[model samples]
Target: MQGRKVAAVVAAVGALAFVVLAVLLVPWDPVPGGPLHPPPASSVFTTDQIDRAEDFAGLQRIWSWSSLAVSLAVACVLGFSRLGAAFVDRVRGPWWWRAVVAVLALTLAGRVATLPFAVLLRRRVLAYGLSHQEWGAYAVDLAKGVAVEVVGTSIGIVVLVGVARRWPRAWPAVAGVLVAGLVMLGSFVYPLLVEPLFNDFESLPDGPLRTQVLALADEEGVHVDDVLVTDASRRTTTLNAYVSGYGSSRRVVVYDNLLDGGSSVDDREVLSVVAHELGHARHDDVLIGSLLGAAGALMGVGLLGLVLGRRGSGPADPRTVPRVLALVALASLLASPVQNGISRQIETRADVDALEATGDPEAFVELQRDLALTSLADPTPYAWSHFWFGSHPTTLQRIALARRFEE
Candidate 1:
């Protein structure tokens, strides 16, 4: 029996690794690249546009499907009966509702905790100024982001368990919608309402900085309704700026820290940053990320159906449903590094776009180094770690690319 157990563990590990490798390596080059590629021409971004892109869409699809399948298999293969009993005990509700609540509460808690940090970072940039804050506020923001993710994920487990018990028949569908909602809120609503909570934002002071920012936008043919500067100094010191919103929601935000950090960044430098932010806004990265999440969830459900259907048994105990969901959620978390890698690649493209818009390689390099140091980002990171876990490429990488463009 002991030997058999060991074998099972090995098998499980092997299967999980296989799925991960498949996902990471599969060719999924959906986005196209080129200087001439018209903006808003396509929803999918291309690699030629990105600094370092992977053609792994096929792998992404396979990994996604296999991951869900394996997650379900693991729950049962490891000890489905045990997990089911635990689920029922923890969430005594009709079963399905309990799981739903568990998932929502767990997930929401994570979001809520990190929200304060994003708020603080913005506040510091606006009030104290980014150049002087020493990254104290930004640190908190980063911490909060982690806290939200951890706590929110915990709550989600409980909610999933409750859901299975309360509404076994429709639990999957309901869970999908809820998960989708969280993704939307986190990606969209939080950047607007939640972001301002920790910072003070107002229209840019009537000055050359404001005028130049707008003029550059016009030169690039990027339309903007307004430019706003936040008082990030009130909280801590870290200079930064980003473009937020989508289509109608679009706007450019600059932190007060950005202004005080430099004597002059030139119109072209500001334009570079603005252009980078615009890349995100124009590509609707927020919406696309959410949609990807929704797609992942749906795929998870389909995989679950395939497994459960094969066994000829619907969850015998509604409580087990949560455990099943938990399995998938866990798998997703494990795959986060891959997702981060994809995001980093996309960000690199945005950087390139920013450079192209301004034609100021020197400014872009300066901005990159300044931002890196301001954020205390390590200039050189382990290649594997960066590829798997880091969301943004290392400072050195960015500087190198900037120099490449400068020449």
Candidate 2:
């Protein structure tokens, strides 16, 4: 009977998801194949591209809003009723009580910590240009978003940790402080904490590849750095290499997959990969990205405030505020595709930089081609999906750009 009940609940949830998807995808009006918005003759894609982009945007908006509604409804059903009761009952009595108290305390701590910092950040952004002000406003909204994320996540961690300590038979905490802390504190400290969890990182292994990497950096007038390899294959089959850290910590980290054979990419190809990554670092793309994000956040908050304040409750109305915030967050998430498009542009620029820095456009091209094949990345994804989820330009686009840079 208990097993049947669980299965029924799972089926119901799956049904809800299917319904939401169907509603979003079924368009009210048919989209035309012709030019929706004609652009200059020299643009990358043609009239069909514009038309498809429009169609996808329409669908994306529908999906975004409807998905939020569906998700919130599910959360409410889960949180306030029998599902929640079942969850609460699973915990051992005194420990359960203690865990609940800890969660509440953590939530309150996050709320208290966030508000003033958010406000100050908002005010600082407003002091800048109109774009800056807009971005700053968005930052304030993001600050609240972070608070919500932090508190909720912290509570989950505390509960899990508490449960592990009390009842080892239920679920082991498995990894030690390094993994736990990294998993909990994701954004800023991810590189510092989570990275060390799986792999060992000593200085760049003495090799020809290290020499070549440093030489390329030197030629580009960029500084020399360590080339560290991490055992990333322990967690994933994905082959990746990146340059991380701001100053002294800045180093190239190649996953074990890159060196070994999840993909057949050689050490030479890895060098080219790191060159592109270094291009991003040298260009200060990360810092620029953070600033852009902060600006967008500030703008979003101010806009959200202006719109919601006029029609609905003030920011203090805790009851309606969360709902309004939820809507605002949904809107922000929907806008992510547009941001991703910008990021792809930057990535292309970095590729060009990589070619110039390395003076090896052919090697870069080879590396990119291999990467595309290895990652099983679509050669041509739907423009809208690419805009939303993809940070790098399409494989074709990157190759073409690399050729142009070489020329």
Candidate 3:
């Protein structure tokens, strides 16, 4: 028994070291900076923009708090109460099927419980002119999202339970590999399979803009075949763009709103956006993110195994489902800060790359201003909130970084 405990401790320590080493080894190219300077409020945003941004920021804060409360309440019910176990006990099926049923039931119930908050948030977005999606369309999208979650979560639960039952002692290592593979598979297929369900994508037409985008990719040594324009205008009026997938599956997607001539977005802003995404492709940020996710999964599963061993419960035990779910939820919540910190670093690197690739820091600044105004992003967000939830640097930071190019 002492031997097993010592082994587990050693394994945990080794896993921690591996994760830290992986992060440290990532090639983070430096961006030029002297002192951290906040951009002037007057120059970064107008009076009207600031007022609208503050209103949106307040609404987001309320939503964030309410959402957190609801999530915690749900987690408590699953972890502390017998409701999850009861459902699993009463369900008539094989162990794997039972796990699936339990996962789906909990997921659906959680979604229902949070529906009001989701609806309220959607209404707030509409009021802020951020989202243009109609109620019916929104409902459709919500259903689609729920369906995807059910499928993915059920598969994961079933796999975990199966592995636990098959290899009670070694399940953690196996499950970790499975989770890592799934993460990579999801990243690879998302551009081709998952994304199209949400928005229609079409190749950018032959034009000076397309020409410029291809040239930017070439300059960055990124072999991007085509830039795809997504029909995001149907759902959102906000300007945005992203890069997804890797290798053959990789592509740059620009929002139609950004491409619309009637919109305030200009060619320079669009070029900057494309260049930023190209930077992600050039650096293979998606692959790096997946690798990190793999490491996290390994550590998480190993930890879960140790906890389950302590409880004298195998993963296949239906009663353990609730505990496992609870642990996973808690772990995810706790890890948010670390995950977001890494994301912000990657995003900041892409921003720097964009500035370098375009050699147009002025355009980058304008693009940042346009994004903040159009998205109603708060120039100054609460430090705690930003630390926990911000995936990218604050808009002011981005603007300040762009201004550094001028110096």
Candidate 4:
């Protein structure tokens, strides 16, 4: 009992430390003292545009939420009941092998259970002319996604079970460090190993746009391997760009659709997008985020240790994996607000950096508006939904920030 209490204390302390570090590092006020009076949605968008956006957004929100609900319900049923334990126990293997098999089975089951909603969501996107993916391609992508999830979940569960089996008493502290380290390592390698599986990439040709992008990278004092374009149009028409990985693996990736003939993005707007990504690179936001995530993982491991202690078993027993997975799902849902809040602020800082890098706010604003129009993003989302789930600043908030630079 005392040991369980200690694990609980460790969890509490780890959580507090994560919050403190996030506060210290996150750019909470990215647009400092920049007066912001966002124009009404109707002021910028016409009745038709607003109506279209609202309709699409409403349906998207519904399907997305329905999928999430189904996933969580599955998790709860498996975790909070004896059925999950019995299901995993039926697998015949060595303890670690059983753990691995259990994770694969459970993860695949959850994915299958929610697959209908996923199909519906995809169909809706197709209806709206957002996704170009055919049923065959979508199935292939879905399989890849399920494979990735299975591999990741298996690794984590196996590690947890093995460590707990080896060190019953002190596994909290040990697993905490181990989980944190794995988070950092995963962040470093994921871009290299996992991302290529989904998208095909080609370096931007030695053209004026590529040259300007290189110059922008130099101006921002960020080192990147190359500016590459990805065939994202194969999946969706969304204009997007990102920076991923760190050190040698770091690079800027732009969606090919961003440069397509039909795109509203001009060279300047593209620069704005690249500059925003560069801002993340400039501040090493990935490293910062990795650190935060590592901290959160450590805290989660501590709490999980306490939960397993209460259950009188840890991951070493294959049956416990389902319960663990369920708890993890619940924890993730609970932690979303803090995770999303920090993300929004980090994205805001990147936006501010874009404005500074280009010294062109009107182009940035235009880019934001066009992106919203393209995605059919609701200009003003429900307050609760935005607070809980909004990762980046709302499109209007971004435009408003750019407008601040106009002054």
lDDT of candidate model 2 versus the reference: 0.52
Runs in model 2 deviating more than 4 A are 1-188, 194-202, 245-251, 261-263, 307-325
Two-way lDDT contest, 2 vs 3, winner: 3
Model 3 off-target regions past 4 Å?
1-14, 17-21, 24-29
**lDDT: which is higher, 1 or 4?**
4
**Candidate maximizing lDDT:** 4
Residue range 50-144, candidate 3, lDDT tens digits: 88899888977898679867876786688658878887899997898888777777777778888888888888899989888899999999898
On residues 273-314, what C-alpha lDDT tens digit does candidate 2 reach at each position? 877887777766655554444334333433443443454332
Tell me how candidate 4 scores on lDDT. 0.87
Report the CA-based lDDT of candidate 3 relative to the real structure: 0.81
| Count of steric clashes across candidates, in order | 68, 16, 0, 0
Each prediction's RMSD over C-alphas, in Å, is 12.1, 19.1, 2.0, 1.3
C-alpha TM-score for every candidate = 0.60, 0.55, 0.95, 0.97
Residue-level error in angstroms, candidate 4, position 256: 0.6
Predicted candidate 4 versus true structure: per-residue lDDT over 1-407, tens digit per residue: 76577678768878987989888999887886755677899877889999998898998899899888989999889878998889877888798888888788778888989888888888888998998888999899889988988888888888888888898777777778888888888889988898999999999878889899999999999887799899999999888999988777777899999998789899999999999999999999988999899899989988887887876855567788889999999999999999999999999999999999999999998899888988889998998999999999888888888877887
